[model samples]
Every structure is written in structure tokens, then in C-alpha cells.
Target: MRLVLTGTGASRGMALGRARLEHPSRYLVDERPLEESEVDAEAERLYRAIAIARDELQALREKLHGALAREVAEFIDAHSLMLADRELTSGLFELIRVGRYRASAALKMQRDRLVAVFEAMDDPYLRSRKEDIDHVIGRVQAGLARESSVEERKLAARVGEILVSDTVAPSELVPLAEHGVLGVVLSSGSQVSHSAILARSLHLPMIVAAHQALSHIQDDDLVLIDGERGEIVVHPAAQDLARFRAWQRELAQKGKRLALLRDADTRTLDGTPISLYANAESPADVAQARTLGAAGVGLYRTEFLFLQRKEIPSEDEQFLAYRDLVLGMGGLPVTIRTLDLGADKADASGLVMDDEENPALGVRGVRLTLRHPQILAVQLRAILRASGYGPVRILVPMVSTVEEMTSVRRLLKECARDLRSAGHEIAEHIELGAMIEVPAAAIALGGMIKSLDFVAIGTNDLIQYTLAVDRNNDHLANLYDPLHPAVLKLLAQTIATAQRAKRRVTLCGEMAGDRRYTALLLALGLTDFSMHPGLLLEVRETVNALHREPLRAQATALLRAPTRARIERVVENLKKAVG
Candidate 1:
């Protein structure tokens, strides 16, 4: 019988390949009570294993240099610190020495204790730290058993193979991509998982939290991973296989059609020009933006530089990175969003306070940055210095009031003056923009737009906050709708207000990238869009096929639709008409 398993689609794509279940070998250590004489030898053995694991991690770190993102490398370094923690080694040694426990037994006891403490934590962000502990200890245990780690075997996997595992760490994602992993299925993970972030950034198809994946899946079974719908077909029947193959072919043809529009201007059929930009997370992504013919970077997530690190990055470090991105774009405007760190993107850099029960409504984005003005000032100075290299804009994220936006603007001016006083040549004019993500901001758009040079609507959070749904909550996922009547009204009001004020407005959220919403956004008077680079050509193709006047009419009809079903019907009709 054909088996279909369902899971959450953490990344967006599809893949078909033979299943390669990743099972890490479990070594059952002899737990016999150790004599006093044997304790020293067992301790020595444990230390040796720790040393081997440390060396292995160091080697992987060196091998990954320049091959992956700097954040991935820092994650490896964090693991190294875990290996060197006295709590793991010395604490285990004390257990073996005093309790007369075998080395493996002592290690297991300590690992369990540490994991228990982390599991008892209230914060999910802190609770996830237990995975790091397990990863490090698993390596040491593999070393003690004289076996290669599961990750090593995974790295040896052949190209175009599907890797099914209980979990995939963020650090493993780059290596898996390098090995040309076709798809990934995990028994546990969420959209906020680092695995999801890396998979999306690398354009890999991934499914997570597939409860029955390992138990039901057998090695060598032909598997189909549909990341779009979060379904995995195991040993599919001939008919189903044929259907999937046809779908794959259709996707390929769609890609080819999108490619044909790579050089085409981002203009409607009636010759109304629109601006298209790419939302980049790293300097490496800048090249992809340029390749996709992005006019400029609409959103550069600067918080990534502060994540997965031990301390705040210095001003010089940030300036160098910002300057590199500025120069890499060849004078294309790079809008740097300063330290939108908090909530799901919490950093270990001691700057973020994770005590909030509901981080989404707590100190986050500009709120957190304002609380730590010294940190904001450092970032502002770096952005100011980088502005001297090319066209740069500073965007503040998560602003619910005009006060927040004006405070940041004032700081930017202060930072510029400080730089100039110290003999630095800063740009005379740097554009300042605000991200309209909060519902309050959208409602108060009229008051906020006057104080800002431009605005970008972050529909991801806007939809979530407006609808009172946590997008990452699997149970609430069904309720998180971009086309919901309330969401549409908020978007319409924001776009209309911006147009009335004659302020430049851009949609730089997931909605902008989704081709289905492209025509709808165009009709609502959104002329600028920023999205993932992979979606650039497809969106541009959508733009090319649309006529401004017809789309406007369709959009007006959509806004007047009283129900989601009606709105969806209108959108579908618009897509069919344009095609």
C-alpha cells in the first residue's frame, strides 16, 4: 500500500529521491561499578574522548571556513565552548571519582541532569539549548565507542539523496547542501528552527515534525517530499508517481518561463514601471540579488551579525561587513535594518533579555534596540560609516509609534555628527525608513509617515499581529491567512495612506514574494517589492503579464469583497485573466 506521511512544511520546494534513513549508532556502555583503581583509567578514557570530539569539531570548523555563512561557523564555535565546559568534563570526572561510576555512566548521568534543567526552562529559546548539549555529548560518546558521528556519515551521503533524520542542526545544513542533498525530512522541528532558516536561504526543500517518518520509512524506499504541502509519499503507487513527475515537469517549465523574464524590466503590460528589490540576510546573498536583477536591497537583516555569538560585535566589525555589502551591490541602495533582534531571533550575545513569557509582544526589534541605546549607537555609527561607500538607507523595524521612528532618526543624526567630529567622511544624506509591521503602526500610518522618508510593510508579522495568530504555532497555522478580510483592509489602508502622502512604500514580506498575491498588491498601488532572490524572476514575470488599470479594478473589487472566499475567488479570476 502507498503510504503518505504528513508534516509541517518548514521550507518551500519539492524533491523526489530514494530514502536514506540516518540512524546514529547507540553504544551500550558497561555500567558495572568501577573499583577505585579502575576509576583513574576510566577518567583518562573519558578525557581522551572529549579531546577527540573537540579536535573533530575544530577540524569541521576549519573545513567550513569561507564555505558557509559566518553565523554557521560561530554556531560550531559555540559547540566547541560546550565541549570545553567544566560542567561536562570536570563534573563528569568528579562523578567517576566520588561515585565510583564507570566513565560512560558518569557522562550519561551528567548529560541527563543538564538536559533536565534545560527542559524545565519556561522559554522555548532557552529550552532549545538542550539540543546543543546533546549534539556535543553525542560526539564524545561516538568518540568513546571509536565510531564516526552520524553527521560525518551524513556528510558522506551521495548527491541528490534524501536524508531522513530525527532532527537536523543548523550547522549541518551547509554541509548537506554542499553534498547536494535533494530534500530533508525531520521528525522534529518548527519554522523558527535554524534548520528551516538555512534550508530556505539555500533554497532546499525541507519537511519537519513528521511524526511517523522514521518508524514507517524504510531504507531505499522511493520518497516524494512536497515542501509546499508538507506531505511525504513513501513508496508511492505508479499512478501517484506519474502525477508527481508531471507536477515536477510543470514546475521546471515554470522556472524556464521565469528565467526568460530575467532581463525584462519590472513593468506592467501597460508600461508602468515598478521597483523590485531582494531581501538579503548576508553579503553572500548580495550576489544572488544582483543576479536576479534587483534594483537594490530592500531589506538587509543586520541582526544576523549579532546572533549565535558570545558578545556584541564591535563597531569596526559591523562597519566592515556593512561596507562590504554596500560596495558589493555596486552602488545599489542597501537598506540596513538595525538589530531587529528579539523574539524568535534571540541572540546569546547577552544583549537580548529572554525573560518575557510572550516575546512577540515584549521588547523586540526597535523596542529592544532603544532599551540598549549604546548598542544602537554603535550600529548607527557603523551604518553611517558604510553609507560613505555607497547609497545606504537605515530602516527601523517594529515601530508602533511615530516617537520610536523619530528617536531613531535623531540617533542617526547624532551618530553622523560623532563620526564627522572624529574626522570620518560620512554621507551628507542617508535615507531613513520605518518598517510597518505592527497593527498599531498600520492604523497610525498617517501620523508615522510624515516623520519617515519611506516605509516597508512587513506583512508576515503584520498579518500575524493583526489576526492575533502566532504564525509558528502549528495549531494556529490554519488561521494565519494573508488574504483574510481584516489583513486586506489593513494593507489597503497602509498603501492608501502612503500614496496619499506621496511617500515611497514597499512590501518587503512573504506576501511580496508569493506570485499569487503579486497582482493583488500591484492593484493596491504597491509599486515596490522586496523578496527572497529565488522569487525575484517569478514575481517580475507576474508583473510583466499584468496591466495596471485592470489590476487596479480587480484590486478594488477584492477590497470590497466581504468574505475570504470571495476575495480568494477574485484573486484566482485575476490570475486566470492575466495568464
Candidate 2:
């Protein structure tokens, strides 16, 4: 009998391969008491294990090249720092020498104690650091057990396998990609977790929070991973195999069709041109966007510089990064979002507060920057300096009122003045935009758009806020519907408001990247769409096949649909008409 397991579709793709379950390290070690005479020997064993773990990380670091190196370096460095931290090492030694416990037992106790502190934190990002603790301790335990060659053995034997694990770290994703691993199925994690983000960047399919994965999946079983639907089929039946083969053929054919559209102009059948932009952060992402013929970068994330670090990135460091991004676009305009460093993207750099009871509704994005003007001022200066290189725009996130947008504009001018006073050449005029993620912002965008050059609709947060559903909570997955009537009405209103004001509007959320939502967004008056570079061609193809009048008619019917079921029916009809 075929067993079907479900999870959250963390990354959007598919894979089929043999299952290779990743058994965790011995967290429950032998806790037998140690004699005083054996204490020194056990301590030596631990010391050797730590040394081995460090060397293994160093070896992996040396093997990385290009953008892959930049992506995983910080996570690996954090792990290395943990290994060298006197607090962790000293605590383990104290347990072994004073408490007379075995080497592995001492490590286990220390891991538990530290994990407790992390899990007790209010911030989800900070709380998730417990995974890092477990990973690091797992490595050390592997060293202690003299199973240092386990990874190598697994890699050698299991090429082109899907990894079924409890969790995967950001640092582990690159190696899995390089090793021909088909995809990953995690027993626990969320779609927005760092590992899932990196997997998408790497173009790897991933499923997360599959509770039955570890128990039901076994080695050598043929598995089918439908990442788009978050389903894993174990030992698929003959009909399933036939369907999967047909899907593979269709996907390949579609890929070839999209490839031919690389140089095609993005326009509807009625000859209305649409602007498609890429949301990028790294140089590799920028290169792909350039190759895909993107109009510009609609969203360039800046928070990666501030994460997994002990200090804030200096203005000069930020300037260089933004400058390179500008130059990399080959003169295309780049919209750089200011440090969005709260909520699920909290930083280790002490810049974000850790005491919020509910971070999603608390001090984050624009609120954090407004509270600390110095931080915002420095970032504005860096962005102003980068503007000297090419066309640049500054986007503010999590804005609720015209007052917040007005305040940021005031500070931007102040920073521009300071830069000129210090002998800097900057763009004479820089466009400023606000993100409409808060429901209040979307409803009140009429007053807010008057003070801004443009506005961006972040559908991910807007839907989450309007529907009152936690997108990261697997239990609420069904409730977090992007097609909810409330969400669509908010989007329609926001877009209509921006259109009436004659301000340029862009949708730069996950909804923009998904081909499924392409026509609906067009019908709702989204003239500009931005997404990952890998998704641009497919979306462009969908845009070309659409007719303006039909989409407008569908949009009219969609707005009157009072419930989610009705809204979904309207959307389905729209998709069929286009098909």
C-alpha cells in the first residue's frame, strides 16, 4: 500500500528519488557515572572531538566557491564561534570533571541547558536557534563516537537521494545540492525558516513539518516529492508512476517554452506592456535577473548583512554592497528596502529588541528604524552614496500611516544633506516608496500614497494580517487563504487607489512569483510584478497569453464574490479562460 505524507511546501518544485533517512546524532548519550581516575581521559576525548568538528567545518568552508560561499559562510561561522565559546566548552568540562559524567553525557546535558534558554525566547527567529545548538552538538557527538566518516559514507552510497531529516540548517543545504540530493523532507520546520529560504534560492524542492516523515520513510524506498502540494508518496503505485512520468514530460516541455520567451517583450495580447522586475539580494541573483531581461530590481533585500552577526554593518560596508548591486544591474533601477530586521527576520546583531510579546504586531521594520533614527540615518546615507552609481530608490517596510512615511522622507532629506556637506556626490532626486503589508496601510493608502512616489503591495503579510492567520503555523494552513474575500478586496482597493493617484504600483510578494496568481493580479490592476529571477520567464509567458478586457471583466466579478468559495470559483474560471 502507498503511504501519503503531507507537509508545508517550503520551496516550490518537485523531485523523485530514493529515500535516505538522516538519523540524528546520539542526543541521549550513555549517562553512566565516571570514576575520578577516568575524568581526565574523558575530558581529552571531548577536546579531541571538538578539534575534529572544527576541522570538518574548515574543510567544508575551503571547498565552497562563488555565491554559494557567500550564502552559507555566516551560518558556518556562527557554528565555529559556538565551538570556540568558553561558555559552552567550559560548561561541558565542568560537567565531566566535577559531576563525573562520561564525555557524551556531559555534552548532552550542556546541549539541553543551552537549548532551554533559546526555546524560552519570545522571538521565533531567536527561538529557532535551538536547531543550531542541536546541529553543533550532533557534530561533536559524531566526532566522539569516531563516526567522522559517516557523512562521506552516506554521500558515497546515496547519490541522487531525497534526505528525510528532522531539520536542515542553512549551512547544510549547499552540500546537499552539490551532492546530487534530489530534495529534502523535514519532520519539523516552517516555510519561512532560513533553511527553506536558502533552498528556494538554490532551486531545490523541500517539504517541511512532515510529522510522519521520520517514522514512515525508510532507506531505499522510492519516493515522490510534490513540493508544490507538500505531499510525499512512498513506494508509489504503478498509476502514480505513470502520472509522475507525464508530469515530468509536461514540466520539461514548459521549461523549453519559457526558455524561448527569454527575449520576448512582456505584453498582453491586446498590446498593453507590463513591467516585470526581479527581487534579488546576491550577485548571482542579480546576474540571473539580468539574463532573464528584467526591467529592474523591484525589491533588493538588505537584512542578510545584519543577520547571524554580533555587530551592525557599518555604513561603508553597506555602501559597497549597494554599490555593487547598482553596478551589477547594468544601469537598471534598483529599489533597496531598508533594514527589515524584526519579526521572523530578527538579527543576532543586538539591533532588534528581544522582549516583544508578539513580534509580528510589535516594533519592526519602519517602527524599529523610526525609534532609532541613528540607524535609519546611517542606512539612508549608505543608500544615498550608492545612488551616485545608478538609478536607486528607497523602500520603507511595515508602514502604517502617512506620518511614518512622512518621517522617513524627512530623514532621507537630512541624510542627503549630510552626505553633500561631507563632499559626496549623490542622485539629485531619489524616489521613496512604502510597503502596503499592514491592513491599515492598505485601507489608508489613499492618504499615504499622496506623500510617496510609489507603493508596493506585500501580499504575504497583507493576507496574513487581513485573514488573522499565522502563515507559519501548519495547523492554520487551510485558514491562511490568499483568495479570501477580505484579502482580495484589500488588494483591489489598494491597487485602485494607487492607480487613481497616478502613482506607480508594484506587487513584490510571493504572490507575484506564483504563476497561478498572475492573471488575478493583472485583473486587480497590478501593472508591475516582481519575483525571484528563476520565476520570471514563466510569469512573463503567462502575461503574454492574457487579454486585458477578459481579465478586467473577471476582476469585476471577483470583487463581488462575497465568500472564499465564490472567490475561488471566479479565479478558477479566469484560469480556465486563459488556458
Candidate 3:
């Protein structure tokens, strides 16, 4: 029987392989009370295990290089530090000495205490750190038992198995890829998770938030992963397996055909030019974007630089990172968004206020940056400095009011003037843009566009804010509709306002990347799109097949639709016409 499981797709591709369940709990030691005579030996075993785990992490770090590797290595190094922590190491030994407990039991108690503290915090980012603690402890526990991780052992035995786990850390991805793992399915993760990013980079199929996959899936059961649709079929029936195999073959043929259109300019049948850009977080992503024919980077998220760090990055450090990205783009224009950190994306720099009851609606994005002007100033200076290398633009995220835009512009001027005073050779003209993500910003687009050089409609947050639903909350996911009449109206108004202002606007969100929405967006007069690199070729193909006049006509009717269902029907009809 074919049992289908649904999840959020984090990467794009398809894979068929036998299941390999990664049970980290298998390494956990029994919490048995130890006799006084055996306590000394158990304590020594714990210390030895900690030493081995530290050495293993160091070895892993030494074998890797590059920006992504450095980021992953930082986490691994943090794990090594945990193993070396006197409180964690010595405390476990002390517990074993006093309580006559086994070393594993002592370690488990300490881990529970630390995890409880993190769980009690109001910040989701801090709470998420418990996963890292769990991973490190799991490694040490495995070392104590003198066994490799279940993942490592399974990979050694089979080359093309699909890995199923509760959660996968970014650091483990390289090893998994090297072992030729076909795909990954996780019980928990988001599209923005480090593992997802690495998986996408490696071109590995991955599904996240597959809540029951780990429990329901048995080892060696044949599984099919549809990364595009976020579907997993376990122990698929013969007929279903044959159908999926045919789909896989078709997908491969389609990919090869799409490759032919890679070098083709992004334009409609009527020769209407559309600017296709890539959204990137790190400089390493530039290579992939360029390969996929991105005109430039439309949205360079700066938050990743702030994440997983103990302190705020210095101005020079940020400048170097920004400069590297500009240089990597080979003179292509790059719009670097200022730090969009808050809520679950909060930094560990101690500058963020994480005590808010509802972080999503609280101080975040430009508001948080404005509250901490010093941090904003440093970032502006770095961005301005990087602008000297190539074409660079500044983008402000989550702007709701004209007042916030005015404040940011003022600060940008101050930073530019100070840099000039210091004899820094900056770009003569760097365009400043506003991200129309908030409903208020979209509603007041006329005033907002007047104060900005360009605009980028961020549909992800725009939909979330307009619908008053958190897309991350599973219970509220059903309410998160991007095709709502109100959302379509806002998008149309935003594009119309930008067109009126004679300012360039780009749709740099998930909607831009989805092929299903390509026709609707084109009909809405969105000529600029910035999205994940993987979708570039497919989106370009869709654009190439489109005729501007017909799409525009279809879009007019879509905007007039009364309900979400009507809008979707119109969109579906348009897609068929164009596709």
C-alpha cells in the first residue's frame, strides 16, 4: 500500500531510495545507578568520550573550507566548546562522584537542566539552540558507547539511501552528500534553516516538517520524495512506483530542455524584457545565481551574517563580506537588504530585545534597526564602503510608515557623509529602495515610492501581515492565502504606484519563484523578479512562453474577481493559456 505523507518542501527535486532512519537516541546511555566501586571508572569513561568528541569536531572543521564551511564549522566548534566546558564536563563527573550515578545518567541530567533553561526563554532563536546542545550531547554519548552515529554507519553500508531524521544540522550535510545520500526528510525545519540552504546548494532533494515520517517509516522501505510538492510516499505500490519513475524520467528530460533556455534572454514572445534576479544570503550563492543566468542579486539578505555569532560583526567585517559578494557578482547590481533580524531570526549579539510576548508584531526589521541607531550606522557604513567595489543598492525591510523611511534615509546620508569625510571612495550614486512587505506600506505606496529610488514587493511578509496569520504556525497555515482578493489588490496597487512614480519594482518573494504564479505576476505588470537560483531557468522558460498583451488582459479580469476561488480559477486558466 502506498501511504502518502505531506510536508513543507525546502528544496527542489525528486528521489527514490530505501529508507534509512537516523536514530540519535540510539546513542543515549542507560541512566542506571552506579555502585561506588564503579563510579570512578564511569567518570573516566565520560572524560574520555568528551575528549574523543572534541577531537572529532576539530577534525571535521579542519577538513572543510569556504564561506559556507566556515559557517558550519562555527557551529561544530561551538559543539567542541560544549564538550570542553568545565561546568558540563566537570559537573557530570561531580554528579557521578556524589550521586553514584553512571556517567551517561549524570550527563543526561545536566543536558536536561540546560535545555529547560533554554526552553523557558521567550525567544524562539534561543529556544532553538537546544537542538545544538542535543546534537553535541548525542555525539559525546555515541563516543562513550564506542559507536559511530546511526547515520554514519548506515551511509557506510549503503550509498543511495534516503536519510530520515528528527532534525539535521548544517554541519552534517557535507558528510551526507559525500556519502551519496539520495535525499533528506526531517520532522522539523523551515525553508530558512541552515540544513535546507546547504541541501539546496548541494542540489539534494529535501522535505522538512514531515511530522510523522520518522515514526511511520521503517528501514529499507522504498520511498519516493517529491521535493517540489512536499510529498513523500512510503512503501509505494507497484503501479504508483511505476508512475513516479515515469515522472522522474520526464523531470530529467524537462531539466535538460530547460538548460537549453538558460542562455536565452528573459523576454516574452512579444519581446518584452523582464529583469530576472536572484535572492541570495551568502557570497557563495553568487556562483549558483550566475550559472542560472541571474541579471543580478535583487535581495541579499544581511541577517545571515549576524546569525550564529556571539557578537555584532564589526563594520570592517561586514564591509569585507559585502565587498566579496559584489566582486563575486562580476559587476552585476546587488541590492543588499539591511539586517532583517527579529522574532525567530534574532541574533545572538545581545542587541536584540527577545522578551516580547508576540515577536512577529513587535519591534523588528527597520523598527529594531532604528531603535539601535549605532548598529544601523555601522551597517550603512559597511554597505556604502562595499558600494565602491561595484553597483550596490540599499534596501530597507518591513517599512510601514513614511516616517521610518525618512529616518533611514537621514541615517544613510549621515553615514555616507562621514565615510566621505574619512576619504573613503564610495559609489557616486547608490540607489536606495524600500521593501513593500507591510500592508500599511502597500496602502500608502504613493508616498513610500516618492521617498525611494526603487521598490521590491516582498510577498512572503506581505501576505502574512495582510492576512494576520503566521505562516510558520501549522494551525494558522490554512488561513495564509496568497491569492486572496485583498492581497492581489495590494500587489496591483503597489505595482501601479511604482509604475506611476517611474520607479523600478521587483517581486522578490516565494511567489516570484513559483512557476504557477509566473503568469499572474506577469499579468500584474511585475517585470522584475528575484528568487532562489534553482527556479531561475524554469521561470525564464515561463516568461519566454508568455505574450504580454494576453497576460495583461487576463490579469485585469483576475483583479476584478470577487473571491479567492475566482482569482485562482482565473490564474489557473491563464497559466494553461501561457504554459
Candidate 4:
């Protein structure tokens, strides 16, 4: 029996010959459809690839003797959907469009484009997605190089979870995501990479870079990947494997416990109601939002629809997207943030500038739309027209100056007039808001908070920018602390200002998901929280269990603590008292 040493996901392969622990043979997998196939062949090929990958995963699961938990299965299905995404499949045709290139050439061209797309980005989250594309490309290229025929092939018997490397297109990963078989390893992935995001969505485990894991892992070697820890354990010892099996069961139990709490209302034993909402990016996620018992959709990020499209997402496209979300909310509030993408999110839609050197400080969010009047006009028209469908409000992101907000409102009025002229019945359904992500915006909240309809705090960017840290770097990640007193002071100040002015205030950043801060936030006298849909119930339950008066009192004192360490100490004490 081979002894396995675990580390992280996608990095779990057997170490090969002793001399070359750094490099392993990479198995290439690329698919080409024959010209004789019918129009439906593309979909058929997608499902077929998923089946091949799934079968490989099934073998591993069987050998595990049912010890691998449901979470592991979620891991498998995530890969299946990736193979089915229409966007990635569309790339195949796009690849053929340029000089009728065959499979290998098309894959290579797409690979280069994928990297270029990410290279242009400045945000670490979106920039990370670029690496996911790189992984997909490796698979497509390998499939092309190894298999010359257009015919389908089963997983090679010799093939044993070999590290597949290349630029993975978003489209190709769709089918894999649906099917959930992520045996493929990525050499490079970005936070914005659809594959990595998919992993987060379905609860799959994957490791981005373990210094060329493919070179170390042998084909089909038994491996354990710790996604949360970012380590892959290969051929683990008996005791270690047993411990992991127990850990798997423990986490599963915790998940079930969380699930049971989902339906429980977020009310304390004494009757204080907590408003819980999901932080979402797409119209499609609203269903998940509702299922999580969220009071409403807190921060509906509307950047993705416009980001990858070649043309400005036409008014009709925007209208349909907005209409779907507004109607889906079923009267629940849907706070839509308009085009928050910076250099962090690269768009070839001919509307955005590709400033490589400094995208974070470059033209994006409200600044982009204000400069491109036509782009703002198109989106505003869609928002207003769709406002008739259901509850919809506009939230602008990246506001460093009030002038940016003013320019947007001027155009919005112009759009409303045009809609009314066209005989569209419009009530006062739209609410204008701004996202306070920059330190400057937070400092100016006293004045800016009064001028806006609502103010949303984007803690992710606020923290990164305030601390002058690139969160993606391993060395600097520790600096990205949510518990920093500086961040809390900014949040408290902005919320207090908005409340004083009687304007709505919501926290839409990941901090809202930190259940530890529920009492503290409540003590700060804030009511709105928008976070990941999955975490909504857990956070709500935490809030519901608290005696608001005491929690508020303790949190008040905690906020006054001098150092981050003391703040954490207070947080721990508060959590213990509540539990």
C-alpha cells in the first residue's frame, strides 16, 4: 500500500520516481467534433466528456468504501458543470471563426486570450479567475495533442488523476460544474475564474498552486485535499486517514446543524428581529437567496452580465436580466449594484479601458459609467423599464467623490423622462445608492451619506485599500484582517451617519458573513446585512439567539479596545456568553 501525504486539492497525486519529485507526467485531454456531426453534437460532446470524467471519479469513490462524505460528492459534481457552460462551448465556435482553426489551434488561441483577459485585470479576485482559465486550457490542449481523432474515448486505464494543465475556458467548465467531477488540477487560477468560483458555489475542494503538483503526483494515486487549508495529502497514513475521516464526519454534522437552523426565524428569545439577506452577483442566484430564508436580496451585483460580452449588453439584454431578478424577488427588495467592475474585471465590450499598471485606481464602477454617458444611458433605460416588473433599486459602486454620484443621477433623470415619454407607467420604484469602498468615501460619509438614498459598505475593498495590502499574496494575507479596529471604526462611522440622516445603510461585503460580528454589528445599531446566500441562515440564527441589550452593551465596550488582539479577545468572550 502506498503511504499518502496530504496537502491540498488538485495537488493530490502520488509522488513519482525519487529523482523528480517536482514534476510528473501530465495527461492531455482535448476534444474535437467531426464535421459530419449534427447541430446537437456540441451538447452531446459536452455530456460525453462529463460522463468520462465522472466515471473516473466514481472509481475513486468506490475504493473509499463510503468513507468519503457528501461534501466530496459536491466536489465531484462541480467539475461536471464546467464541461457544460455555454460560454466555454461558444469559444469552440469562436475558435473556429478565426480562419476555421481546428481543435488544437482553437484551444491554443483561446488559451492565450484567457490569460490576456486576466492579465488586464487589477482586482485580485478577478485576476485569480485567470488562473482557472489557464487550467482549462491545459486540459483542452492535452486532449488535442494526445488524441488526434474526433471520436470519443474513455479515460485511459493508465490515467490516474494526472495533473491537467492549461487555460480552462469558462464555457468548458460549465458541464463539469453540473456533473461535479473535479479530478482535473489547475496550475494557475484566479479569484474571478469561473471554475474557482464554482468550487465555492458547490462546496468543492481545489488547490491553486502547490509548486507544480502535477510533477509530484502519479497518475491515479490516492490523495486527500484540504481545500480550506490549501493542502493536498497524498497516500496518507492509516491513523491520519482515520482522523480525516472523522473530521469529514464532524464538518458534515456541523453543516446539517446549520441546515436545521435555516428555517428558524432570526428572532431572539426576547423578540428582536434581524434582517438577513444574501449577497449575490446574478439574477439566477435569487432563488438560492430565498431558499436561505433571507429577508431580501441585499447586494445584487450586476457586473457579470456586461463583463464578458463583446457588445454593450443591449438595453433588451439588460432589461431581461433585470426583469428576471426583480420578478424573482417576489416583492423582496433587490438592491442592484450597477457595473462595479474595475480593472479587476476586464471587459472587451469596447466600453472599458484596459489600464494594466494601476487598475484599482483606474476608471471603473460609477467612474466608468459617468465617463461613458452612452453606457450609463443604456443600463439606466433597462433599470427603469424593468422597475415596472418588481422591487428594484440602483446601487452605484466605487464612489470616491460626490461629483461621480451627481453625474449618474443627471443621466438617470433623463432615462426616466424617456421611459415616461414612451408611455411606460412608472412609479417611484428606483432608489439611488452608492457603495462606500474607498477610505476617502468612508471619511466623507457625514456629507456624502446625507446626499445619497442609501449607502452600502464594501468591506473587501475597503480593508484591502485601507491596509495597502494585495490580498492575493500569501505573505500579505495576514494583513487583510476583518477585525482591524480601523475598518470597524470606518464601518461604524458610515452606518451612524446614514442612520442620522435617515438613509438606509447595509453591509454587503464578506464581513456580514462573519457570524462572530453579529452582536457587535447589532450593538452598533445597524439592521441590514448582505452576505453569501449559504451563510445567511447561520448568521441569522446567531443574531436571533442574542439578548440584544447585553450584546449591544458588550459590543460597545469591545469596539473601544485598543488593539486587534484585545478586540478578538472580547469577541471570543461575547461568543462564549451567547453560546
TM-score of each model, in listed order: 0.85, 0.87, 0.82, 0.71
The 0-to-1 C-alpha lDDT of every candidate, in the order given, reads: 0.82, 0.85, 0.82, 0.63
Give the Cα error of residue 151 in candidate 3, in Å.
6.0
In candidate 3 the C-alpha lDDT for residue 117 amounts to 84
lDDT of 3 by residue, 1-579 (tens): 679999988788888899988765665557778888898788889888888787777778778754356556656755765676676777788889998888778778888988998778664545657787788788788788888752365465257889988778788887788788989998887665567767876778999889989888989989999887899999878876787789879988988989998788999988899999998876557888888889999999887677656888999999999999999999999999998877545355766675666667778899999999999999999999999999999999989988998999999999999999999999988898899999999998887677899999999889978987656543355576878999999999999899989999999987898787888998898999998877899889989988877888887789999998899789877865563
Instruction: Say which candidate scores most in TM-score.
Output: 2
Put down candidate 4 lDDT per residue, 1-579, tens digits, no spaces. Answer: 544233234222222111112122243323354353432444344334434544544453343212112223333333333344556657866555433455555556666776787667655544544544544444444444444211122122122232333233333333333343443445554332344444554444455545456555665556655555555556666765776678768767878878887677787656777788887655446787877788888887676666444787889888888888888878888887887656545454667675445667778888888888898898888888888887777899999888888888888998999889999865475789999999999999887765588888888789888887655533355576777888878878888889889998899876687676787787776788888787787787688677776666676667798889998887776664464
Cα error, candidate 2, residue 24 (Å)? 3.7
Question: Candidate 2, residue 433: CA error in Å?
Answer: 1.3
- Candidates 1 and 2 compared: the better one by TM-score is 2
Selected candidate, larger TM-score, 1 vs 3? 1
**What overall lDDT, based on C-alpha atoms, would model 4 receive against the true structure?**
0.63
Which 10 consecutive positions of candidate 4 have the poorest summed lDDT?
Answer: 13-22
Could you tally the backbone clashes for each prediction? 0, 0, 0, 84
185, model 4: CA deviation in Å? 8.1
Q: Each candidate's root-mean-square deviation in Å? A: 3.8, 3.4, 4.2, 9.3
Model 1 Cα lDDT, one tens digit per residue, 1-579: 689999988788888888888754355767899988888898888989889888887777667643136657656767876777676788889988998888778778888999998778665445666777777777888788778764686765568778998777777888888888889998877764566766876778999889899999988888999887899999888877787789889989988887887777998888889999998877667888888799999999886678667889999999999999999899889899988877445367777775576677789999999999999999999999999999999899999998898888899889998899999988999989889999999999998788988889999889888987666544455677888988998999999998898888889988898787888898788899998877799889888888887778777789899999999899887775473
Name the runs in model 2 displaced over 4 angstroms.
Answer: 1-12, 25-28, 37-94, 110-133, 149-157, 191-193, 308-312, 343-349, 354-362, 467-470
TM-score of 3: 0.82
- Candidate 3 Cα misplacement greater than 4 A, ranges: 1-12, 34-103, 106-140, 143-146, 149-157, 187-202, 207-216, 228-238, 304-312, 343-348, 354-364, 467-481, 484-486, 556-564
